[model samples]
Target: MIETVENRPQPKAAPLVVHVVRQFLPNRGGLEDVVANLARQTLKRGYRVRVVTLDSLFTTPDDKLPALETIDGIEVVRIPWTGSSRYPLAPQVFRHIGDADLIHVHAIDFFFDALAWSRLLHRKPMIVTTHGGFFHTKKFLAIKKVWFRTLTRLSAMAYRRVVCCSASDLNQFIQIVPDGIAIENGADIGKFADAASRRPERRIVTLGRFSVNKRLDHLLDAMTALAKRDAGWHLDILGAESDLDAADVRREIAVRSLEKSVSLMISPDNQTIRDVIAKASLFASASEYEGFGLVALEAMSAGLQPVLNSNEAYRVLAGRHEAIALADFTKPDAAADAIEDAYRKVATEGSALRESLMQAAHAYSWDAVAERYIDLYRSIEITI
Candidate 1:
């Protein structure tokens, strides 16, 4: 059995740590999962946890969320916001976090800038986690670069700690804050620990948001190549629609005549996802960008070998973890070749590789990452 967060003795005075993010639950992506897992870890450390988020999801603005609610034992308060989702402006965060001992700003967006600018009024020790530093895409990148150096540089001064979630992020952020530290985004690895088959099949499974940056088109083409080679090769795509429309992906699957071999599941529950992946032996993704490639890591934790896009984070992870394979996702044959090679190894050395993959993922388990955050919180208490 995996060792979970140890139930530490409760503090005499539980300090509140409020997480400020652009969007939370009802949106199941990396940022949301990262914050939710951290909240759970802190709560286990005897800390009072709360989430302050926007009332509307940028994906579906017309659908409004509750103003207040509790999820997984964490209190959440939703605040209204306006402006582009890239940098949503929500000033109402001040009202919900007046009593917080520490304000944990997630991602590099408006919440990050807003709390940093109002440091004097809140007077809370703030720490910001750079979730890929908000440069996921190259659109308007010139303006983003200017903003990062100027306004973002000034905001870094207010943060007690600049927690860069990956080494890639560390390289980008350390220029602004010399003391920036690297922390692996903690994953609920145990949820699907050793969930894949002992002697797995040729089925390929990938899950996450169907964001354009994920390069779903490339993934479809890769699947097309695999299907042409062998009608037996199957692909399971499990994800919710983000900026990319679900209908577009479905239409592409039909256009490529891959509906027979490729299966798609939208926003499945935790158990449902686990069940689907359990039947598959290999995992693959064509994502061109990632904060830390948490889904790929999560799949690794499940004893599934990953064939990932050659993005910086995936390249670094593939470097550190031998179980992962990197491929040129833009080239469909290259991606298909990588996927085929991974399955070949899975068939030949499935049990040994599965164990090795699971062992490697344990290093990034929530049990370890959360301990790092708890230590940081304790250190901050002294200065508070």
Candidate 2:
């Protein structure tokens, strides 16, 4: 059994720590959430955790850096980057990380940072977590994929340990670096449970940024088909929309005449998103690929059935259970069939499904996931 940080007493001496990432502080993505939770849990275990991140989308120049702040008893240091891109070449970041016992880099796309830190701060044990590459076929063209693959390969070689959020993500890295570790992602089950109880109505909801890879269009298409068959069906999409794709989605919705059936709401607070998922009759994701599908786990914990693609991440995280209604997107009738099946089952056997899903969801609490990371950290020989 995995021992959680809460189960073990804290060590008297504070362990030095540094977390390097492309972006942090105010970022809304999964990587930011993981780093924040890790910092907090490590601090709870009596370790000093400092974060070094580029002032990208989330952070601003007005944002103070080297400014020490405590979150859940952990000390965090937010830093600014001089480069234009989020993954900038900042040599100064390594300067702040020198005194730390271990330096954990959030994503491998920060190639320059990974290369510089590994070479300059050789004394520290460097761990890299590959949070999925931007080179997925759906997102990148042929030329872009080659460039990203090369960059990721170099970064993987420099890191002491490679960590992936799911086995699918680990498998992706294994093609480049075979000796990587698969660390399952976790969520706060209590918060999700609360959200579920407060949900608004029996509706279908999907949460993610409006991107091509997310296959939001496919979701709308599926909803359109469902509406033709059953006029009562409704779908809600909640996510941040890029100006480039917003027009396309709008055009597609109008063309399909799905304006009445599907509602598009832009990015909302985490609690608001959770509330939406909780009240939803079914949680649907049409992504072509996923590193871990954190949203699916969140929805399942809230007793909402997830309609996800039959991918390794979903298979491993969700397990071989009917709790998660798995669908193969490649199949012609997969989405429509799965949606109908899930809706019908939810109506007839809702209580039983919720109970089983809630039970399975218990395995993914933050405390349990944090313990796994701490165990990995302990197992590693930290020379610094």
Root-mean-square deviation of every model? 2.9, 4.8
* Cα TM-score of candidate 2: 0.83
Runs in model 2 deviating more than 4 A are 1-13, 58-91, 111-113, 116-122, 138-151, 197-202, 241-252, 330-333
Model 2 lowest lDDT segment of ten: 194-203
TM-score of each model, paired residue for residue: 0.95, 0.83
Q: Candidate 1 at residue 29, lDDT? A: 89
Q: Which candidate is the best by lDDT?
A: 1
The backbone clash count of each candidate, in order, is: 0, 1
Top candidate, metric TM-score: 1
Q: Mind giving the per-residue lDDT tens digits that candidate 2 earns over 32-138? A: 67788777777776676778766444323455544455544444565555655434666657567767677777775554345543674466677777676554345
Q: Which ten-residue region of model 1 has the weakest summed lDDT?
A: 3-12
